[model samples]
Target: MGVPRAFPHLKMRQRPVNISNFKGSTIALDVMGYVVKGHYRMMKTSGLADDNTLPDSTPGVISSVEDIVRTIVAAGCVVYLVADGKKLPKKAKEHAARAKKRENDLVMAESCFQLGLKKEAKKYLARSTVISPATVDSLKGIAAKFPGKCFYFGALFEADSQLGYLAQNNLCDLVISHDSDMLLFGCPKVLFTMNTKGWGFYYEAVDIPTALGWKKYSYEKFLKMMILAKCDYVKNIAGIGIARAQKIIESSPDLSITSILKTVTTLFPDSGIPDDYATEFDEAYFTYLYSAIVDPMKMESTRISPPPLDLTEEYLSFAGYVHSREQTLDIVLGNIYLDSGRPSRNVTDPSNLDELFPPECFFNSMYEHKKEVLEFDVDGWEGPSPNEDDDEDDERPKKFDCVECDKTFDCLSRLLYQTVTHTNLKAFSCHLCKRTFGYRQTLELHMRIHGGVRKSKCDICGLTFTRQDILTNHMAAHNEARPFQCDQCPKTFKTNSCLHQHKEVHLQVRRYQCENCDLSFKRIRELESHKSTVHYKARPFKCDKCEKDFTRKDYLEQHCLAIHTSERPFVCEICNKTFNDSAGLRKHAAVHSEAKPFRCDICPNMTYKRSDHLTRHMKDTHPAKLEEFMAKKKKAKRPPATSTEEPKKKKPLESTSKANIKIHKLSPQLAKLVGQSMMSQIDIVNKINDIVEEKQLYDPNNHLYAFGDQDLVNVLGVLRFKIANVFNLLNRHLE
Candidate 1:
């Protein structure tokens, strides 16, 4: 399994992407995760075994995968169905432990079901759902439908590693999966939580800086964080979470595995960190970095990336077991059993192969076949033709081989270039940046940035870029394209990346309901505000002039604007009517119009420009139907509410003590001002309030009473005046 809650944690930064956004792109789909998810989804929704038995969700799972693959192919995407082959040797114990737990859970589920604990039984049953290699095999039939468009492959080890390999090597444009670890594996782009509708959350590795709010970050640091928080191959140090791991990595002077581990040991000495933690971390890291993947071009097993020269044979085993070229081809062809190293009996059927995989099926672009159809052996095994010998292919040219890495190149010049990669020699250097390159061509390309040599120019905004790909990306901003539309709202975004963030605001409206009262809130923020205002009776925002306490800053601002200030900033354009807030101005402007846009369903003749006005008419004219209409309206406006009880209140002294503990969190300037004050803390607070009142800072009519300072000069000037007055008052109080 991936790091617990990894997907959800990363999902906050996910961009909402439409399925069609990836049109004409090759996407590697992690078939196993979806297979498991589909099984759970069907079991939960269909309730196929409504009685006291667990449902066989195999059919439902096949249907779900089929729907997903077909939908993706329908969008003009070339789909690669990546299936899990064998578990890594390191994960054997974990797998065994999970298997035992599932067995126990299944027993408990059946017992609970017999006792009529349907809900409890379902929870246990979900945990017991087995997604085996056979479940993955069932999906081959689905892949057969769009044979040319969709191809199937079984990874040597993990499907995620295979997907990541495909993405990193440019075999696929995107990796679509539910696992967040795919990102840690250095997949450039991954689409998570995919639905059949083609909507999903998208992530690109280049956006890590923006996503994590970091000035800069590296893939190495990201992988270390995942390993520290526990991954498939490594155990985690106790008490360390994803957030803590990130902080630990950020605080390190050096983000190297060795330096970060030293820092962890220093920070959490008693956390019982494993002695071989470094080895485990290295294994996990290299496993993600150089995992074995089947090359679509060569049709053979190979590491995702070239392994280090110093890598041990034992460590290399973490990637995957080395398989023969024939075995690798058979695995990709789905002719062998994934769980056991044996030929799949069903795959031997010539009729199934002929029907499912047509002559043009499979990756027709990659392989050059000698025959039109696949040949089967007398022993019920399917593979390449028995007549084809490796010796026949040995006649191909193998000159210009690099001695250092055993890599062959077609030309001597290319071999010379490859040789430079193994050495420190850089004959070519950029004059502007002093950056060295092994080749003259690369140095020339680097000079384009300094010379401002842009060949690609946008027709829309007339912006230029050094590269055509950069210009293509920039064109998206000017294309007036908003492909990502919210399913819950009409709002659209240029990219799917921010769609989920925007939808969160609307999706949770009235979702949190108060158990103690009938009140519900549109967001967690609203519910929190309700709790702080009504339940706890906490007034955080205080009006300095009137010494009145308000639960919200806006409420305090409104109080100051209405009660103390004569300023009416928001004015109706149609009329000369003024209001304190823009909302009031908008409401006032509606009255000036004669148009009645909103029509009452109960009475077609009754129409009003405002929706609320139409609602009011329904209540007044059709009282009986009003409740029904309002009920429907309320349901439409809000999703089902989850009951949340009022949080237990802490004692006043306890709350104050906690507040005092956090006093160090105050700004250094503010803390210094408080420290230098002659008056008591309470008296200083009152004095500051008096100064604010005297300055009329909250008065919107005053020149200094701006909602915000637009520039550094204005901010500094306002702050300087306030500090001077406060200092004078402190000195006077001391005297």
Candidate 2:
């Protein structure tokens, strides 16, 4: 259930105490453990009876429950019974595994029975014990008989968490449960194995960390240790038992699972750790720390019934067990109360239990409170009582004021909301704009404005809006959508502002007029922008690098790229040259290609690379033909106004340019041979062969021209110089 053998190792120093020691104290009872123990006791005495005859076990079970309750009540202590709820979500796999184990145990028990090992068979059969639904119903009926004494949580809640909550909140002086996990749940004090005899060991929450020799280990560290030891959710690491786990946890610099795993792998090289061990550990850790449980306030709301001395017939009948009145009374009243020779009191009897055993008596009985108080002398000293100003304070109305905004509210909650809204204590903030909002929903709405995220789409026109309300308003535009009508005209518009603008056209009104110029606009923002840029020459947007400014922020960004930055993002595949923009690269590509799609209509042979070049040629050569060509171009480009058409697509760039041909430079000797030949200026290669043959300078073995003398070297030098000049001219034309 928790860390195995963790209780004995972490138990506080305890001594034997009698039932009278806990008089007038409030104790929380773990009802599930007592019920299970009682059932087991009944089964042992009745030789493990079948389901049909199990009702006979109810008296013994009821006897056990009453024994524990009466012992605590006889000592003048209050008992609040807490029962476990339905199976926990985190324990689902464990529950299934347990069921499988029970099945195997049943098989083993049957095998043992056939082997004539009756003792071994019974042990195996006991291992398969399960609490039936009928037993649970019977227990619930018994609890109903004593109203306000029991609490049942939701189906998926844990009883230990409720017990811890009650103890931690001071609702109970100590929790009485067999579960050691209550220590991890932060119960300040817990009494374990508390039975009718009142002989049990109690552990204080502080004793755990102290016994573990932890300097800074918190509740979380303790939980991590429990998880490492293989709790209900997590599997144990092979070769890493409780002792090794404690060492690993204590020696680890970081308590995180990742850090712990790293240290474990280093320490135990032979132990093979699973790859998904960290993930499993995380799941277990979160389940233990954050799984839902019964609220402490809800536990407090449950009624507490005074201890019952006599048994009720309704409870006896519901139990379905045939027992005599004397036997039922004995079962309801434990040996501690009955054997003490005290007469049982009826429910109708007048008695003040609080007066009989006060809380001060219990405090005095504790061993820790055995020391006597030392008296100090005080001469002529008087102090005001805590309730001295209560009369004056009660007359005034309660008010809460925000410290930051200096605003007063009727309630503390309102003041807290206003304070957080005004202060920078907001949870949500925008990274781009550096703006903050008090609520996440408000921040989400603001993000939509920045991102232009229009998720709500209109079915009619496919227009979208960031908000549902705006989308709903836009839906009206599909059919009889235009409700705002102009009085002067029959035309209608979707919005009142649109109708007002249309009416202005009839009235010939220009609401926005420039102060410096005669320019007028329907909107004031446009007029202000024009006046600032053209009249005042004001540039609000400035570049960070060059200190240059522009009226528009977009223009300032463009200026930064074009002037300050030498970033050539566009490349010409034809020439392998880079340009600042795609437009520059397109114009540069025209030099390498011969295809000119734009042609003159007047002259069939005359063509231009670009449409603008064709227009320029037409205007320069023949002005009359230019207008006709432009009219034809416009007619060809025009589409029907009713058609929702897309813009013309750009031509895909060629991967490899056909005009890219490599040229080689002539060697000095080859240049010399060409210069000496008569056809050197025309057919250079043929001229070089003739010159080599005439001069007898051709090597027959290598088929190469050889320079024989100093005269040849001088002639070759002059030829090389003239060849270089000619090559330069050819290179210029290629470029």
Candidate 3:
């Protein structure tokens, strides 16, 4: 059995006397969200210019262990950074080079691979501890990396796990992060947990309430109320938060979460959470923030429904933005998959499809569309204010530029470059949310999103959403035509979100990231959704057979099947096995090279592509690879290769500007491509003919078309005989 928790919620459990046992220790921050927020705040606070900053400077401070270490040293603490060292040497080199890294990226990521028994890890074990995610099958993986080798590290975490050990054993002083909910997990202390910036940044422990005088409750009560609010959020309630929950509790000082839980259990069936409810909460929180949240309004809102989305028509009626919410989601998913052609969305097939996309619901594709991706601008105001139309009437002039970027723009947006500038304003405000913004135009936009107003309405059904694309999609249900079909399942939606959400039914995964620090989540939207709704956020590494994203790129490529892809075009002189991905092929061939031959730059890594990828791999994965390789070899030289890989063209997305926005919004180019690639035009026409013919038999009164075109009807006398003759021929062929 596992060790039990202190049940921190139980009253009279005075701060454990040994709490200081966690003091003065070091913690690793994901540094992604914070980094981005920091940069945004800096740019907003100080209008920057080219000479003052670097281009792509938004991934705020603390990109590397080196940076963290510097901060730690300044604070007078002994610290060590936990890293996926297998890829370190490569990644450091990439940071040195300003190569193709993303503009808003926190730091370059280097893929960690399982290599044979590592000698360095064993040596490091004697001095410092190291940890990896808890999901790696190290016994099998280690054996493969070093058939006869053994390794020892001071400490080692698994491939995708962090908690069972970290929790039972106190590893540090406090967990610090933007999300303060970690206190519920029995974390000792947390700081820099507020949403404010810079000078406003402050630290708080579990006992913050006592520190700041509360009328009826203590600090623990304060923590409990906030945690309750987070727990309630996991259930889809929109207006619940720390303040609201606090106010509720303060109004009834005698009420505690224990009582609330009891009432909920008695009243709300299934509130008797299953044993692993904690894990569920963590997954939900992580997904809500990292993957996709269920919002009919926001950019990362959960997906649902058919198209010409029900919300699209309504939004276009008033909202001026030409793109609809569903379209935005399509673009985001397109970016992630890097598919130039939009994959056909078949959302009409799911049984519970209505759970997400109700007629009046809205949502967006979040994983890909960040503020940086959209490049939106914010306006600034000074004194009483000066109108944009009356710019000449202003006494003070505004100025700014991005230091690291190539171009400069006004501080009006705080962003460097953008395709559109904000001019029309809205005065939309939500009484429930109590948040106000710049323009009437902005207010109108917000109102549409928050249900204050409806911007999109389906022409076919009059269903609405804050976004227009959804309404257009809703109209597709009345289309009388369903074209897109899934290769894996019978499930389909009129739109992609509906279809994909149904697909989640077959997936099996539970990836966990400690919200206590900074880290990146490819599925942040889902994480946020989970956090906003779940109770105790437990840690679990997910292994879904099919996933929109994975903890590691290679995990799902070959189904994580024991036998990897044999994209082995490069046959080993020693073996004749084939391979699929070039990287796998190279990994298999590594045994044959005697010259320590597969050096990527200065790092001890393998290579698949020629110089560009190799150089990139060195710079991004192993900073030490290139220099070490040069020093070990005495000179940088290449092995003679008689054969090489053919240059492959990266398929870029073709803009669907003139795409048919009719009832069925299928792109003409995609339709043609699908006809040519998946099936022939003749095949499509034949399939349609078969459906038409089948329908004709059921409804004898309907006009029959001999040709495929709906407009070309068969003249009864001549076509009747022709249909019989063609079908007769078809029967003979079938026979």
Candidate 4:
């Protein structure tokens, strides 16, 4: 739902990392989703929902937040727990849709209960999750336990935008969330799908270019594509998905949003695009680019980016309205509840709140009104009311504009008919599969696939499509009439647009240049691979099957195919020799050629078709010289280490101060050893130094613990006393 399938589409950039990797760094966590999930789990397990309202799941929500925050803090990270404060006006449509869904789920749950399906009833009941103000207040109590280690922030609207702001401004080192909207909000680093077992998928914004196979990285183009792919704020053009949106963006001139939209409209002329699509696109763009976030340091509300001087007031409100400083502080501090809009000024003073109202009273009355509204409206709910002017305007012969899409019509009847295309409510449903569609035409189109009634059939592939244009596009694939060919490379395309896109590769400026050799690549990964393989000779990618390592991931994959896999997909045309990969087959084909391009340097008479054969000839024919040759090759593989730059000299140990010894609480046994002979002191000091240097017991950078052999002989006495104490405890336990 968030840019649809964005998480899976970015699988290439996702890295599985342990939670401990962020040790000693600040992380901002979005806890609202976990709140809903925890409530569902509790409702499902306990099966104690009251009237299917889940009034008892509040404790489970609190426990969930506590568990998640404590788990992260235990891993040595300082967590900034961020929760949603209020709903933004831009998301009102989405909120209504969700409310309708919950209402429908309630009806389903009630029906299941009547039919003696208790388990199914509970399952449907659990999906009706609502995060309330009481949940946010409970987070304050959880944060209090850890003090500086865990700080809570109640966002003005969305927690993801707040988390993104924290990450972008370096207020936090990482953001822990599964929301793809964080990517659109410009969070530099996000850890998604993390579990309590300390593992998660990680992605960085800089990896987008390499992961998506783009010649260059452009956040503007990426955001545009994600918007066109569909988001919470706007509906996407029909028939266009992530792949097609990317193609459209890449092909557009000047790489502007307007041009991209124009391209989309051209590609999908009858896709029912909104008449005011340009405005919606801008709103979605600004919503991601300049979301309102509370500054953790300043404790005040502010937008992520400064608004343009020429920007309108309406666009500015997309970030959220600015309230008084006191109101903003109260909201950010979790004094105001998110959903009910109730003020709990005494929340910070728990002693007063408990005296005024019992703790159970505060929670038990949390959502009683919400439950009543939902239960009463389940059957009689008729959705939101139509505009009051609809009936009056129908009598006049005036221009009518559909409110959802802004499409104008001469008559109100025509406008009402077209408005159905954009509304979420569905009246017409498929009889065969019981699927609903907003329009009858759409339902009929869906039925064609189920009925196998495709009208347009292909002559060559024997495949059929519902529409002529789709069939025409499919026919082009089998046409094989590539009249347009690339002059730079041995490639051809059926269309001029495809050929033009291919030609761009030749002209693409390689902006990412290697610092070591100045070799350029169109993408950052290529530059990274060149640096790792050609300059550093670092083999970081390793094969788990054979323990063979390579400098690049693709090289490791190829090695796995050639060694571990039995499937041979590529075959040599001349000798019929099969290989697991195309590169191996190509190498094998060279053996059948008359030309021998590779000649051994040590043995000039020996010639071979492959470089590896020449290397083998040199090794077998001249073993002694081959050793020297390998040494030279290895030396050339990596840049020579600079000898002029001297290694960092270790600082001489300072004398241990009395204050440190007192703070560390030296044992009486250590004091007894300190009063012994100088010879014994020196012996103990040397042994202690050996242990310290070998095991790295003390921080090398800590001047207070840096000890000199002559001045810190008592250190060994202290260590011996501690070791003796441990053994004594073990001995006592054994008895």
Candidate 5:
């Protein structure tokens, strides 16, 4: 509602002026704004009651208000407390909408409280702030108590408009309010956030032009910019944000609604400017510029009265009558006049009657009594009765008993955890899987997998998810708004979990260790997959046609397309020849480019289309070079060899560096099938080529491998490295 991004740009132009600079000046105070602000500040400092309701008048609120008022008077400024009256007829629609939203928020807050989500409940509760009759009565009581303070309750308009009218008519030199709308209301000067220390921000109307770098800046121009940037009155252009709207406004000399629209459309053609934008803009511009403000001449005259000497008693009496507690009254009075030579009371005594009466005590006594009765006779039925040793309650820790297991614990959290794990207290069960869950939300999430019920759908990609939270996370990918940033690097992520996972890379904490082998992974999921594929030899994904098994689903799909089906999805652009996959097409396209990217470091002239080809060139042409490469590779592969290690513990020469051996012109089918085996692509390729050469899959007459039958193909498809064991296993199967 305030000018969008207005303060960030204007901060450089802001001049720090103290309250002493405004001595002898008259100021119109937005009394309700200060009251609301004070109430929230009090609620924050003083913890909320057990029932989560804010205390009507806290010591903090009274002290803060008194301090502000005292500071203004000491500055020699005549202060008028301006309160909002009835809503304007034109604003009634907005008022009703706001009330409806507040009601919804209150309902959600209550729901969250019932669900034990205290933090979320507090957030919703904060959004439901409203000025009730009690608030008005309290403000009136304050005004009545402090007679010297001039108080004005407007009859037909908001306090902001009335304050602006008074300032414009020279009745007040400055308007003091937290509401930024005071500036838009044509108030000449305004002071904001005045604390007890006589410190606050001073915003002058004359500085607007210089701050915005627009010499011709007027109230009308400012209102138009607010409309374009989106105020309560107008819906902004779909893709036009505050910065873009400012640019549009600054580029045009004439700040008419039509001219602004035309300029925006011309400059940003992709802004998705609506067809009825002009109509909406005109309405918002008119409402802000003309309809919103009250005429200064029509407003009533403002006057300041002298304060009564007996104001302290009036405030003390009012507090006692309203709160019905003498202790609260004492605290309020002490805070109100603490700096005015008045003796203050100690409000921190835990044994005080007011402090002892927690909000939960009023409503939860019956429930507590029932629980106490149940605790006494766990195996038998009993009626509720008062505990005789209630005076000694503070001496011992409260006990919690798990009803299902008949187990008792000193804390409710321990009992609840035990109940979930060791008892049949899980009421929510999945229909399909017959699995029980301790919570209803958990059961609902599990049901999504079996029922295939996905209600939340993304608008852009039409992808659906079982949960709304999941769908919200998915939408972040489309917008590319990574709000969770890494402290170690420039990389940002859409979710906190992603950021947490990325942080482990910097820590290098490989916590998930494989039990069968010494290999470890950073994530538990990766380690589990490794164990299933390598150690357990589980091929869960099966090709439908040939019944060939694969460790991964992607591998099974690739096998079906490359071997079983004649589908060629990727086509070569130069020759128009087609292949089964992109890798095959890339190999074919390399012929058209006439470039050999893979080259041997030892021999500069030796290059090939495939890495395996370059490897064979290095091995066959230079045996000594191959041996040197193998020795270095073997040393790199082995863990740091201990000096005192036994000869038996040392790696056998033949068992090491077998993956380093190379083969030339390997078939595309073998490349993809081996790629899907959950093994390193480079190592697996070399190992497969070794097996093929040992088994004689490659023909002497042709450069390509010739598969004689389906059995031979199947043997190659299921090939994995087991040192010298791989060739013997393939020979036995093929023979």
Candidate 6:
């Protein structure tokens, strides 16, 4: 038989060491937390964080890494980076599920933040190294940064129940969470404190025993208790609690869970069988135990999680200044260095550049320094020796393999990262979930499914979810969570309630009527709504008629070509039925489809009119094919004689020619219609109010322009000039 797997007892010794003892600590953070934030920010606009009435409660737990970094740095610890191996590329998918769940607005923002952060991190990263779980490489970016610093990865000990059992067995340091389940799991020294700062942290460390507890669990007994309670993952006991389960297990010890299960089955033969009952229970229980005992591997271990924080708390005064710089390349490199914990020397100490000597003086200084050694580079000023060409004839560039591309290339990390990460390269894949990741840390998060560390879970439904903030949004749907009320209607929603409530006016019974026009609407919102309310869209849909704006392109097209482009495409094949429009052709085709649509009001005259005429003719005259031929013979079928020419069949143009041709024709009148600017009306009121200046047309004394025959003509010319000038000004302003 194959060796059955045995869960290991993974435990650590609890030292309760002081923070001062670990002064030179180096921490390696996985980027899972940061990626979560990136993912969250990318979704904020997708109705996820909508509502001004409530504070923004978006998922940004991952970004908490930034704070961790600052805290660690302030504590005088050196930080190191270790990139997990890139995941292998995955198959191209037409229906990428992650892509579908994403909103258009967010994808771009996430991309921007991820790119910027990655670039900045690369600049001052004291040490850069790559490591893979498979390969036994000793090098680590964090370890390399400070060779002597004590190494501690943030997730050194995970939330594993078996580990808690082991911690109990080992009298380990407190589990820093408030979950009561740890007590049942057998974790000793559960400390409910270890916050980021202040005297409480120090006090807890010095007085550790006050928060500490002793070990208490017999493994076999604990397992038996869990099973009897129907709490062991495999069973489905509808109404069992810890207290009831303890009594059952207390009454019966040394009973194998499997045997107990068999007894229950025999006693209750009619009970529904659990699907894969044995397999299911064993898998869940053992799986949980194994994760506690084992450390999961992550790709690109170098990334740090994002700062889990309130945006207002982490706000910056000078957020973005790199874009405006004298030297763009320098600024980019400088920003990268700053983010990576390095301050540029030039920016810090300008005097290091030195007083400007003459160019020759500077050159001479360099020459003097070199000459002081009494050696010159002139010996190597020669080109390749003639002897080298005779020995071997090779003048090609040397090749190097890139880990990212898996191809030979020049050593350009930027190009490699771009080709591999920015594109659809899957550098990491989660063994548990089968999800691809750019790096291993991301995959590490996915692997957490196997470990069962649901840090972020749904609170409202008690359903465990992966992302914490996603649960926040889901909870909003459960109650009267929407506090923002609409001004126009009784309806209330979390966001955009006002606009939507106003839109409801269009649907209500018509109440507001346009006094000047016959048109009326149920609500004032709709009645007051003008075509220009489409604002930006209206500007883009320039009409091809007298200078005008339309909210849609189809409407603009109809206005432009209604008279000239009104040609019918659909037609009836029988009786040569045709129509100038599609509506007529649609009506005519129904006649053929139904065979006859006309009804005869007279006796048997109800037959199709065409058929009735034919029948009458057949009875009155010869109706045979021979008679039809004779009738055709009586009429002369003349050939065309105009220009003595045959009507040549028109051939379709070549594909290239068709592409070159413009399909639609726009009349000058249509062009004029669209040329009118949307802004022309905007500046009129302001312009009118600005000027009380007297014009020749306006009399200062009468406040009116009374004109003679010649004055009228002059006034007409002035109006034309003013209108033309307005259009010109609008064109300039728009441009």
Which parts of model 5 have CA positions greater than 4 angstroms off?
57-63, 88-123, 145-149, 274-276, 292-735
Candidate 4 similarity to native, TM-score: 0.48
How would you encode candidate 4's per-residue C-alpha lDDT over 1-735 as one tens digit per residue?
367777767662236666666777777888776676677767766655455555568887788678778878898987877888777766777878788677656655664455454665676787765655567767778888886578667788888788877777666778888578888888887777566655666677877887678987788889988888888887567778888888788878866668877787777664545557788888888888777777644556788787787875565686586666666767766887756678764355322433433222211123111121101111222222212211221333377656667578885436545655554456565543345676546675776555545657788889978665677767779887988899998998887767876775665455554444434555555665564455434454556777576756677778888888898989777778888998878788887889998777755777888867867877888887888877776665543223345533322233322211222222454434334322232233333334444444432322113233322333332221211111121221111
Looking at model 3, residue 195 earns an lDDT score of: 26
Candidates by lDDT, descending order:
1, 4, 2, 5, 6, 3
Query: TM-score for all predictions?
Result: 0.47, 0.40, 0.26, 0.48, 0.41, 0.23
In terms of TM-score, which candidate is strongest?
4
lDDT of 4 at 534: 58
| Best model number under lDDT | 1
Q: Residue by residue across 1-735, what tens digits does model 6's lDDT show?
A: 000110011111122222223344322332232233333333332231222111222223223333434444465554322121111111012113233323221333233234443322222121111111211012222222343331222121223342353344332223333233343344443322222330011112222223222134355455544544444234454344444444444444335556655554554433433445565545434423332221112111111112224422123111111122223222211212322334343232212212321211211122121122111121222232212222121532354344445566553334334554537666454432234565434554565444544545565677765544445656666766667666656766754534476565435344444332333445554443331232111132444446674444455555555444665455577877656655456656655564663433333454553443444645454345446644443342322122335533332445323422322332333223334333233233123212212123322222212122242222222221221122222222332
Candidate 5 lDDT by residue in tens digits, 446-469: 766545567678989999886667
The total of clashing pairs for model 6 equals 31
Runs in model 6 lying further than 4 Å from the true structure: 1-62, 66-187, 192-217, 224-235, 258-273, 276-279, 282-735
lDDT, each prediction:
0.66, 0.55, 0.33, 0.63, 0.55, 0.34
Candidate 3 structure quality by residue, lDDT tens digits, 1-735? 001121222221232111112233443232222433344433333432333322233232223223333444344332222111122111233333322223112110100001111221122121121121221122112212322121111111110112111221343333334333344433444433222211112233434445334644453455445544554223322344444455555554354444544544444432223333343334333321222112213433232112134445333221112234455444322221112232433212222324433232112122122222111111121121111212121422255333444455454234212212232122233443334454334544555544435545666667766555556667777876656656678755676666666664443332333242222122434554333223112111223443332322243445444344434454555787665555666676655655443445333458543444555676677675667744554433422222245423322223221111112322343344223323332343344344445444312211221332232122111222222112222211111
lDDT (tens digit, per residue) of candidate 1 on 1-735: 678766555653345666576677777899988888777766655553546556678888898789889889988887888988877776775788688667657655654444344555676787787775566567677776775788777788888888887777677778888788788777887777677767666677776766666787778877888788888787777678877787788887886778887788788654556557788887778888878877766667888888878985566886686688777767776777766767764462322444544454334443343332111122222333212311222433456566678688785447556756776456665543345677656775676665556766788888877765577667768768888899987999876556866777654335565432456666556665665455434454667788787767788888899888999998777677889877677777779888888888866887887878878888788888988988888777654444365443424555433422331232334444445423343344444444444444442332212222222122222322222122222322232
A best-first ranking of the candidates according to their TM-score comes to 4, 1, 5, 2, 3, 6
Question: C-alpha displacement of 544 in model 5, angstroms?
Answer: 38
**List of clashing residue pairs for candidate 5:** 148-307
Clashes of 3: 133
Clashes within 3 Å, all models in order:
5, 1, 133, 0, 1, 31
Give the higher-lDDT candidate: 3 or 6.
Answer: 6
Residue pairs with backbone overlap in model 4: none
* Residue-wise C-alpha lDDT for candidate 2, range 1-735, written one tens digit per residue: 667778656654243334455666667787778777676655544563453122345667766777777677767766766666545555666888788667656655554444344444555565577765344444544544544343222212466755765565566776777777777667776767665666556567767777888777688888888778767776677688767788889878889887999889788865656547787787666554444443333212221111134534332221122334333222222111222333333221113323422343221122132133222122232333212312222323377555556678885336545755565355455644344666545776776655655667787888877776677767766767788888987998887766876765553344454433344555555565665455434454556677575766667666776777899888887667987766677888887888899877678899888878888898899997877888888666533222135523322233121112223344444445444312222244233333444565532322212333354344333222111112222222221
In candidate 4, residue 160 scores what lDDT? 79
